[model samples]
Target chain A: MSVATADGLTLAGRDRRFGLLLTAPGLLSLLIVITFPLFFTLYTSVHDYTLLTPNYDTFVGTENYQEALDEEYLPGSLWVTTKFVLASIVIEFIIGFAVALSLHATRRFGSIYYLILLAPLLINPVVVGLLWRMLLHSELGIVNYTIGLVGISPVSWLGDADVAFWTVVLTDIWHQVSFMAILLVAGLAALPREPYEAARMDGASTIRCFIHITLPLMRPVIAVAILLRLIFAIKTFDIIFIMTKGGPGTATDLISYYIYRAAFFGLDVGRASAMAAGLLVIILALTAYLYRYMNSLK
Target chain B: MRLFLSVVAALALAVSAAQAQTIRILMETVPDTRYIQELLPQFEAETGIEVEIEAISYIDMHSKLVPQLIAPEGSYDLIVVDFYWVGEFTKAGWLMPLDDLVERDGVDVDVYVPKLMDLVGRVNGVLYMLPFYNYSMALIYRQDLLDDADEQAAFQEAYGMELRVPQTWDEYWKQVEFFTRDTDGDGNRDLYGTVIQGQRGDCISMQWANYLYSQGGLYHDENWNPLLDSPEAIRAMEYYREAVEKYSPAGSEAYCFDEAFNVMAQGRAYSFVTFNILYAGFEDPESSEVAGKVGITPNPGGGLNGGWGWAIPNSSPNKEAAWTFMKWAESAAVAKERAMLGGAPTQAQIFTDSDVVAARPYYPILGEILAGTKDFPVFTYTTEFVEQVGLELNLAATGEKPVAEAMAAAQEKLHALLVKDGKIEE
Candidate 1:
């Protein structure tokens, strides 16, 4: 029996080694392509490098960080990014949750509604931005034309600073709500119906049944959906870029757009990397916090 | 064994030699790419070489060029760059010294329009770009709307001038205001007085630059410090604000070059101040509802010229092909063909050609304006400086802030940026 056990141990060890060897190429690729660049960007953030003068880079150790912290740069961008993130996530969550609930309550043609609702999520953000930009055009845009019929003056959907912000928010919600809906649908489906039935038998109102039975049981799903949408909405770039490029006096310029201008437009890679690093830290912190909170709930 | 090894080395050397001379060319999408596209096959057939071309938009080209240039890896051999980037490109050493190439080819560099050629292509006295299809800003207006000279004069009397093409900033604004009268006499307004790109982007920067330069306000002084918010700059911004608020669409702040173009083409606008390149589109009856009604005149000047250029990258492997293509594209023959094809040509020689000039009767006046043009600041700090100015200018123009305070804040931020970039001492 001892001899057989020793042979089995050797076999298992060899199998593990073989598996590692097979994955070596993928491992190397991931390190080179992903891990290296990420660390390199972190390194660049502490230096002074502009693409136009690549050879002239100097170690500026946290200058970029300090500069970014200035009220003009970081604070305004943070505010814009926060507003965009909170607004998009809240709208997406509420709308998505409502859609999910309706789909669940409905008895027929459910799949068709699901497919139709899921369409926006599948469309590329760039295409969505272009479509909305055209629709929101003040002079020739159909949105303004339609609004004019109601005896309302055309609202500069993409021109006025305030209106442009709301336009971006609505466009974002329109595009991403489907993601939340699909996730919530899965959650709703997986939910145990016993508590819901019990609440209904006790003559609980629809709202009361949802609050006491449906929501309490679906906490894990809601948490996951919120986390997903929050992460996505924070990193939103394409739609804003296509629509306004953070325009009308930087009113709509989010942190992501600010970083893009720094890196690509400003050609200040070091500062851009610094900004990116700052974003990375914030995102990681938020993620950790969420994970801890989720754990605490358990 | 030695002989066999030698043979393998020889074969490897031969293979590497064959791959040594390849060039990549990047440019904006020209309608026919007539100059480069037509001559490329002939070039390859003659030179026993290969060429690859990548076409993108006016904005996309800059994003791609700047990153590649920063690396200086020489990934591309040739580039078709806009005239505005000449200064930025030359200062970065991302372009090869073309003085030798011009000398070797015995080409007279002076023949190219002085303004477009010198804009950014010369950094501390070195050429970096060649002029392709040259252009200057023009005022496109409705001819039929202004055909009655007596009516125009009478309106001008009420407004204060003869209303010939405006020669000054005030005159320009007056023209916009006068033309803006509700022609239909109906309660509902049918047309805007004018349309201009007022959005905070490259268009805003370009348009502002034209006006600012016209007012003789330099973006920076000798030491490269921010000089915007100077008296002249303020005046220019004020003029822009007044024009936009009084005559432009409600959402003028979001208007881009294309949107402004569409506004005039659709006949919603009585006049449009934009790039001369749009002349082709405006003249095409299919594209424009106001084809015969569309008239062109020299861009109203407070006395300044503006234009854009074609440039090659230092990294381009196909430098010869690119130069040859630029030459062929900018050649008199090509320019004439472009002119006859109903597009504007960059060459002065072509502008003088009767056949080319006759095809478009407005060519003479446009040619005169093109002759008087000048390029924007070609410094390395141009992009950043312009961005700051544009943001502040937009804020002021949009009534978000007092123009004076906004300009001051912009100047302060710009000064800091200049110092940080080492363009000026703190």
Candidate 2:
């Protein structure tokens, strides 16, 4: 019995060693790519690092953070970012869920419908911005030309301060609404039909059945989808960079683009890194909350 | 063993030779740089020295160059720096002072235009770069229209002035307003007057400089106190706002230089004031509808004077090879070649080159304009000033804020920035 136990212990130790060997490369890669940059950004936030005088000799702990927080434009950028995220997510969710329902109800050529829906999502964001910039050009664009044919005057899609904000929001939806639709469709497909059938037998209308059955059952998926999209929406930079560039009197200056201007244009990497670290913390807290919420659902 | 040793020796020699002979250059993707790229083979064929170029957009050049500039050894041996960066690059000790090299090489610096040289070549009595090109803004107009008999009669009757090239701001405004009418009978206001390049940052800054400088306004005094609140400054801002709000295209508030030029080129606008670098683009029949009908002159007050200068970075391992390329590129023969290819000329003689003169009738006028151009007051924070204050300028011009309030905000912002950089008294 002693010999058998010793052999078993040796076998278990070998198995553990083999597992470590298999994961070593991936672990090292994660450390190099993710952990190093994260620590460096935090380290940079504490020091007075600037491209103008790229060094860490001056240790200004939390002063950079203070300045980033106290930045005069910070509130404006945050307000703009919040408005953008809320507008984008609310519109995208409504449109995406409606499309998902229609697609779910279809019985034939569903794959063809999905192919058409996924095309815009597959094109790069920069390409989307460029294509739209041309298509929406006020004087020389096909959009205005078409509108002129119908007696509607040309609209300044990216020029007017009031209109440029909604223009950016609409461009984002055109690119990312597909992502929301696809996720909700997957959720809708996985839902069991027994609850719906039972409600129907009770003489419940379709709307009542949906409210009583589909929504309650799909709460977990809905929560996860909205959370994921909310996180993505908060980090928007590409469309603003390409289309408006936070222009028309700072009407579309989202937070991510503002931070970029601070880093490269302001040449204040220390302050910019502090802002970035602050942004990272907000994102991480949201993600942690999402994890807790998902677990709670379980 | 002997054969292996000899092979290793040969490889080492080859590597060292390649390293010594090859030089890398960086330039923004402007037309001049594109022409230089095309003419690089002539340089290599003549000197037997190889060259490499890394090109980037004008907006991204600063961000891309900083990392390499700060490195102990940089990748680029040569760079084309904008005039505004002359102070920033020199103060940072990032550029190699070129006075000694110029003396040693016996290169005649007299060929370069004097005002152009002063704007870009020398800083604090030190020569850091050779002038590459001048981008001083100039007025481009519809000369054919100005010469028409009926238009002149109508202009004299309407404004009691000749419909000729404007020599003052009031004349410019009157012409712009008068010319803003629908020529086609559809009555949709198809043709606008002037184009205002009020796009957020550099576009508005450069275009508005034509107004500001002509009105005798300067960005700051020697002590770094902003002069944006002076009478001249306020008047300049007011005039700019009036022009943009009253006579420009429907969405002129967001037009960049390219779009502004396009309005004139497409025969949609009567005239525009912009950089002379885009002059040749106006002459192209393929892109321009008003190709043969356009004219050129100096801006009424003066226009923004900006330029490119060729310099070697301090981190360069091969200065002599880079200097060789610069000398060849700036030689009279090659400069003429580039100018004929639609590159902005830095040499005085190139502006008068018979071949170039015949090709571009506006060349002589550009030379006069280059002399009177006003430059942005550059320091370490000049780019930041242009960015932030330019935003204020846009705000005022777009009527988002009043001119006085916006100018005050700009002055305060500039003061705070200068104080932070220790450029001025707190």
* Top-lDDT structure, candidate number: 2
DockQ top scorer: 1
Error of 2 at A168 (Å): 0.6
DockQ, per-model, please?
Answer: 0.66, 0.62
Q: How close is every model to the real structure, measured as TM-score?
A: 0.91, 0.94
Q: Which residue pairs does candidate 2 place in steric collision?
A: B214-B301
Computed on alpha carbons, the lDDT of every model, listed in order, comes to 0.75, 0.86
Candidate 2's iRMSD = 1.3
Tens digits of per-residue lDDT, candidate 1, B1-426, equal 999999999999988776664556666776534446655676577666666777766656778777676564656666765655555566677787778888988877676655666653455677766666654676778877778777587876787667665666677677777766566865445588788687876667767666776577777777676777799888878777876777888787777888888888889887877777777788888888888888876655522345445667766655676677666656666657767775556655666779877777777767776775655555566676667667787887777878788878878877876676677788
Weakest ten-residue segment in model 2 chain B by summed lDDT: B185-194
TM-score of chain A of each: 0.90, 0.92
User: Per-residue CA lDDT of candidate 2, range A66-119, in tens?
Assistant: 998887778988899989999999999999999999999999999999999999
Chain A vs. native, model 1, TM-score? 0.90
Candidate 1 docking class: medium
